[model samples]
Target: MESKILVVYYSLEGNTKLIAETISEKLSSDILEIKPKKDIDSHSKMKYLIGGKQSVIKEKPELIPYDINVENYDILFIGTPVWAWTFAPAVRSFLESTNLKNKKIALFSCNGGANGKTFENMKDKLQGNEFLGQIEFKDPLKNDREENVEKARKWAYDICKLNIK
Candidate 1:
């Protein structure tokens, strides 16, 4: 079977994007960024905090323009930051917008803490596809791009192998 992988993610502070890019590099996959339809107020830290919590509580997100054909890829390498123990609202929005039936999916999360709980939350949300596995780079690695990249690459390779693709 032929396979095409797409690395899709949302980054509040760019670390998640870096992780996605690293996965793409290791897998030679395409990349897609999920942007919010509504912009958060430039100076409002409270808005981000509130919005992120609302997103997780509601299990939804409002996404901006995404052009990916959900059916085109065989594997999806989904990356996101953990917000309120789940993916960022933008990532949730992206998942809700797309269909993943019969696809192979893996998740990667970068968080400010250990993130085991966050991964569990994400693993549940990704049920539309075969949940190959997940990788989490916790607190120390969040701002360290070089280290996270290597970690993401390894995660990507391991997932690729685990799925026997």
Candidate 2:
């Protein structure tokens, strides 16, 4: 199969979705949106923070659709919102459902704080895949969507060239 980059993510309040779209547009790659079987109402920040853990514990992530042969992708740009200081439950589900052997996997997180442990939690979920690199944005950048996307694209290029040091 021919190689391509895949930008996969789950967005709760449109920030992450916009980031994903911008990266996809710049990279000209396929985009996949990960949706949960039961949508969590994110209107209340406190509710989203609490409900995310419950959803993870229940193992109830469901995607609206996914058809690309993930294995064929040379580089996988996995994006997610940091929930409970970790990878989003829907992203966890997507990672679990796919086998990422021999593929380069880079992570980009739209999160609320500077806690670096977010990647640690992701490491626990993606135990077997080759972790390429990670780029994270705190809550302050929600208004600077274009700038964030440029950063993500640069990060992707760095990963592809093994320049993430």
lDDT of candidates 1 onward, in order:
0.74, 0.73
Q: Candidate 1, residues 113-154: lDDT per residue as tens digits?
A: 746466676666667668888887764244666776777778
lDDT of 2 by residue, 1-165 (tens): 545788888888776787778777767789888888677777876766566665457454676666778887777788878776677778777877887777667778887774456678777767767888888876524556667777877866666656222
Task: Estimate the Cα RMSD of every predicted model relative to the unseen true structure.
Answer: 2.5, 3.2
Residue 14 of model 1 has an lDDT of 65
Worst lDDT 10-window in candidate 1? 138-147
Q: How do all models score by TM-score? A: 0.84, 0.82
In terms of lDDT, model 1 sits at: 0.74
Clash numbers, per candidate: 0, 1
RMSD of 2: 3.2
Candidate 2 wrong stretches, greater than 4 Å: 55-58, 140-143, 161-165
The global Cα lDDT (0 to 1) of model 2 is: 0.73
- The worst-scoring run of ten residues by lDDT in candidate 2 lies at 156-165
